[model samples]
Target chain A: MKNIKVLGSGCANCKATFARIEKVARAKGVAVTLEKVEDFAQIAAYGVMSTPGVVIDGKVVHAGGIPEQQQIESWL
Target chain B: MFEQFAHFLVYQLGGLSPASQLGTALHFWVMDTTKILVMLVVVIYFMGLFRTWLSPEKVRRVIQGRSKTLARILAVTLGAMTPFCSCSSVPLFIGFVEAGIPLGITFSFLIASPMINEVAVVLLIGLIGWQLTVLYITAGLTVAYVGGIAMERFHPEKWVEAYVWQIQMGEIAQPAIDTSLRGRHVFAVSQVTEIVGRIWLWVLIGISAGALFHGYVPQTWVAGLSERENWLAVPMAVMLGIPLYSNAVGVIPLAEAMLAKGVALGTTLALMMSIAAISLPELLILRKVMRVPGLLLFVAVLMVAITLVGWLFNLLN
Candidate 1:
């Protein structure tokens, strides 16, 4: 089971990443729930200072950039 | 000898006021000086805590994700939330790729983290009110989003060192550690001290300069010479800011004073952002991580993008 956090201001990159994640998840039949973290305070709690961040389980796995599709699938 | 004498006379004639000038200078100095001292301790405290809870390597190792786009979006959103100052950015940048963060996505995070912060937002809300504050937030976030995508498109692989792209071995083997309340308190004080120590001077300079411009300079000068009329204000301001560094937290107070003197919101913001993001200080720091060409490209793109943002904001208002 994977819990996904797509952290960013609702912008093109944020939306694009969510779309890509969903695409890969659906294709791979992975069990995952995507949560959108928009509040600035909550994002800080995770110690992330960049947008479009990804958190899996309890740890922040990505903060500055987007990872590739295959990588997401593998993580799932 | 003639030029020296002429300059001496100009200084004497520009006399404006003694008490008011000193008072204004003091007022600006105290306000910004306080921020510097506080931020210094805060940043250093965070550093100690950072070291305790997250190893440099462990911190690097943490942010590895699946989808590139999702990661980028998260980075921007996260950037907005955490409100990173310039100081925190360096170590984090070093640790990020070591943790397996991607380049294009990292760019998004880097752009957003410092641009849209809580301190900036609060200051904006208080000084300019909520509407413009929202506008600023929207514009800042959008830049991170679009600018990030643009960077991805151009793919400046040359800018990144070969080693920076690959994951570096971290302190994964270290024993589990926990930081307590007393330790946290000490860390916070130190952070305040460190950040304040360095930036106090900047705060003073920013405010006094702003106050002088506020009280003395003709308000018509800024309003009259706007881009719609002069065209050069935008680029000139941008160029000026690129080589200078100023914090939004510190700059906003000055900006408020400037607006009081008839300076338009757009021009003030443009100059502020330029000083914060593309300034020489930030650029020089970037040089450590990026080659000259890569640095230039980043500066060029960011400068053009922020200027347009400032312009659109003025138009809307």
Candidate 2:
């Protein structure tokens, strides 16, 4: 199963990425699992320095800021 | 004759109960006001002082390489002294790694940066008494020291990205600001207002949370779980703390609130420090520099050590 992580503090940017990811995922009919990681330690494990990050299946796809929906879709 | 004198004095000074009440109120007011005022002064003074002494490049140079016992100590002590924010945590990592510092010693720097900020320390003293103030500082410094040393022993250098090594080395210049005695005072006041004023909200939040725990959370409940032997509470606190990014500012308000609510001082403080210091956000940020294994080890060591510290304080106090 594809696992997606939207790592953020529920900020607008973080939510936006989640919405975008959800939109992109829904369009593709991907049954990927999504989770929000807010913990500092877990986030460090991913090695990302910025919020509004995206991790697909365990790879950090975006960091510090939100990437475009298309970029996220590519990873999915 | 003495009895008569006592009676006359009591009559002159108003009723004994009223006099006693006045004395108690005065005592509390003096204590509260002084701690707040003096702590503000001291934090301001320290901030300005660092404007002269501390630098990231210097920190890198001091802690780098094999002879690291000294470096770890300096990193924690000095790391606590600096006023950088979570955003700056990344830049500092780049600076330290480039300076040839060991992974563990740099961890010391990272933990201390936010956990023991001056604002948190001073505000702590202001709200709580001096004993806890000293205890927090000592515990933070000790954890950084011991934790860093452990990391170095079982060292993992593979975690860092090769890109950090590619960045050009730049010298850390001394602080740009300087002033006379009067200028220092003015600088101190301005720094107080600037730094403290900015984070007052955070302080309120942290203290409030703490106060809530203090007031509502039963000591037996925390004591049951937070004891050295307890399996659930320590990990839960650390796990809960990991994701949250509560700055010193946000934390202080919660602390105050917890204390007001009768929360166990040690337990709330332990959880609070964990959030502010060993936060998952910081770990995630650090992972960019360190591998997953290294990051996990760091977090594990910190969790155990801080939980132990919390347990010990609870027992002693």
Report the C-alpha lDDT of model 2 over A9-71, residue by residue, as the tens digit. Answer: 566567877888888889999888988987544554454434556777766666544455566
Error of 2 at B274 (Å): 0.9
- The prediction achieving the highest lDDT against the true structure is 2
Task: Report lDDT (CA) for all predictions.
Answer: 0.61, 0.65
lDDT of 1 by residue, B1-317 (tens): 33333233333454424356554444444444454445445444665565455432343343466577776777777666554534334435645655667766667767776677655665566446678788777877777777777776777767765544453434322312325877556544544554556555655565556546644666577666443534456667778776566666666766666566555677667776776666565555556556888777777778888888877766765
lDDT of 1 by residue, A1-76 (tens): 8889886656445676788888898899988898888654354456554446677886666654344565677678
Chain A TM-score for model 2, please? 0.89
lDDT of 2 by residue, B1-317 (tens): 33344344444453544245443333333334444555666767778655444455455655666466677788888888876555446656766665677778887877787888777777877677678788878877877777777777776676666666666534332222234666556556657666666665555444444434543555676555534544355456666777777776566666565555445556666777788877766676666656788788888888877777777766676
Q: Evaluate residue B11 in candidate 2 and report its C-alpha lDDT on the 0 to 100 scale.
A: 44
Cα error, residue A23 of model 2, in Å, equals 39
> What does each candidate score in C-alpha RMSD?
16.8, 12.9
Candidate 2 regions exceeding 4 Å error are A1-76, B1-38, B64-66, B170-175, B178-190, B201-231, B256-265
